[model samples]
Target: MSGNRLYLSVSLLLSVGYFWLGWSLMQPEPKHNFTPCLFKNVTGIACPSCGTTRSVLLITKGHLQEAALTNPLGLLAAIIMLTLPAWLLYDFFRREKTFYNNYSIAERFINKNKKIIIPITVSLMLGNWIWNICKGL
Candidate 1:
């Protein structure tokens, strides 16, 4: 598949996964964990993203504070999950490469600021991991 098609396919799949998660969450009692963190399973400690799924679900239910407490990364993930697919669809329908262009711009910006961005990102992730551990997620 072409790069654009690949991007679209992945985005659509993620959207479907989110829908499934929502459906599962609506059940009186969910029998399965849709998202299992491998790191947590192996290490017996919550990973930085361990609670992201719950966080995203809370966000969908309009519980912003609860979502934040679950995992701040979920807020970023939810934003991407909601916006990326729509942006990709718009680009596909309009025969535009706006998404790709923006992705390239972001890549360049990150590369240009890696020295600063990398440290900040690592620090944030470490902090989040500590938070997850303390929360017993």
Candidate 2:
């Protein structure tokens, strides 16, 4: 069936992607003191994605306050980035041939709350950023 092929394809792609990502992470990352932000030339305000790497680095160094100062959202983003690949792999593996044919209630939550959830997530991130900036002062 088409669904089965789709599942298999996704699994294969995720497997390859996970392999590449692990390989890349094992290698040494670049050292750049200057921060990079696309909005630097435009609005001059650091975009929402700015300071992401600094936040990640700070988090890894166990500097929670510094990580949050750099970007609270970025720290959360880093957590998601770290877990997403594993989640994708899990999902990919389970999707095959109806391996997880009966989806759980938790999985059903995704389709049930999109309208309210999205705006709430945006508001929470914005609030977190504002709180972080205020806390820095």
Which lDDT values do the candidates have, in the order given? 0.84, 0.60
lDDT of 1 by residue, 67-121 (tens): 9999999899889788887888888899988887777788899999999999999
Question: Where does model 1 exceed 4 Å of error?
Answer: 1-6, 9-13, 30-35
Backbone clashes in model 1, listed as residue pairs: none
Q: How many backbone clashes does candidate 2 have?
A: 0
lDDT of 1: 0.84
lDDT of 1 at 91: 82
The TM-score of predicted model 1 comes to 0.83
Best-matching candidate per lDDT: 1
Model 2 misplaced stretches (Cα beyond 4 Å): 1-34, 85-108, 128-137
Q: Count of backbone clashes for each model?
A: 0, 0
lDDT of 2 by residue, 1-137 (tens): 35456556556765664564455446576674343455644655455555655676667678999888777765675676666556556666666433234333434675698788879889886776566445441
TM-score of 2: 0.52
TM-score of each: 0.83, 0.52
